[model samples]
Target: MAERLPAGRLVAAQFAACAANHVLPAGIGASAVNLRFLTRCGLSTARSATALAVKAAAGGLVRLGLAGVLLLAWPQTPRLSTTIPRNSLAIPVVGCIAVAALAVALSRPLRHRVGRVARRVLTDVRAAHGRRSRVCALWGGCLGFALLHAAVLIAVVRALDVTVPAGHVLLAYLLASGAAVLLPTPGGLGSLDAALVLTLTAAGAPGSAALSAVIGYRLLTGWLPLLPGLLVLALLARRSVL
Candidate 1:
């Protein structure tokens, strides 16, 4: 799809989309902007939106599964605190169920209002699925990206002069990232930083080192890219590509 546009323009659009996540609440704005950009890149609106949703869902599942495996394999890992927050996990699950139930109850009314939109999305996903190669590529990219993300964190650990094993760093990163998703902050922001510091510290790194590593990781991955991304975004927008 990107081959349809100038390479620089495509890159710019992507950078803009990513930057949107940081400033927007919970990434809703970023997701919407990315979907629109995808459509502008030649995908149908429904296909673009569905593809994003599918990729996100796949990535989430992969992270959760990886986190579970890490926890199970290292069952003796130190507990960060003696007492867990009351209903911490249960609250989100219950809230999701309540929201789902409410949606179901309002389904008739919703259908009347947005039936066309829903049907269009379903049709697009079905059509996209028929292209097996594309679906496979999408999932492959998602999984690959997840691994690379963890690897970056592992590098951050090393850069901090932390002697923790690479495997431990990877596991801590995976678990922390998975936990961060439960927080409602955009791009996980403060929540992700806290999770990473705590998880790394719990994994045996010195507390100061863990905190420093988290800060450095975020600087490299998040802050450093912001200006260039915004510049690219503006360049692309001026050319009418986004």
Candidate 2:
């Protein structure tokens, strides 16, 4: 983060990483590309990985925070319960917590590893927060990106003449994006599409319209950038920048 990296190369690396994301689950492809790029720019591998972890943590936290705020503002929104049935969500949630706790308690090595990773991530988070520039760049970028994606989904819904409220659409998009983390599909391909359509439908959108909106969103966000991203990736590779 302290190094003077070339702005053009940094942008190129991000473009290439987005293209790479379609092949790897979750965001492994992008993370690997960013890690390599940072190391190439003279950062240590450990620092580069920490920077990525911090960025990811910021993104996740921002999504959850925005959703929470929205829910608080519009308590009557039906976006959440439609995704998971009312009165039926508690069992699985509690069961997961119990199972995770039991496993951690039973496994010493796992506990130690978890503790080490947690501490490292916490240290990285703290260090990033200590720097005002890093804090602004990290959280602001994450927040802006999440809002832009939500706005896209809303626009798609409106263009299709869906009747769902903008707040509801925003909340639905956030919830679907959060849920998609569990599936870890490449670039959230099938999982996000399914979750978003389901949520949108539950929020009073017609099923057909919801599906169309999701498809349109994917085309704009995923497919459109893919070819250009790949070209950038190839060029970067040829230049030894990737």
Report the C-alpha displacement of residue 152, candidate 1, in angstroms.
Answer: 1.4
Determine which window of 10 residues in candidate 2 has minimal summed lDDT. Answer: 81-90
Tens-digit per-residue lDDT, 87-173, candidate 1 = 555588799979966886778976564667667767756665677776676667777877887788888888878898776777778
Against the true structure, candidate 1 reaches a TM-score of 0.82
Candidate 1 Cα RMSD after full superposition onto the native fold (Å): 3.4
Q: Against the true structure, whose lDDT is highest?
A: 2
Alpha-carbon lDDT, every model = 0.73, 0.85
lDDT by residue for model 2 (15-98), tens: 999999999998998998888888888888877887887788789889878977988888876546457543343466688889
Candidate 1: pairs in clash:
none
What TM-score, computed on C-alpha atoms, does each candidate reach? 0.82, 0.85
Instruction: After superposing candidate 2 on the true structure, give the runs of residues whose Cα lies further than 4 Å from its correct spot.
Output: 2-4, 85-123
Query: In candidate 1, which residue ranges exceed 4 Å CA deviation?
Result: 1-10, 42-46, 78-90, 111-123
Q: Count the backbone clashes (under 3 Å) in each candidate.
A: 0, 0
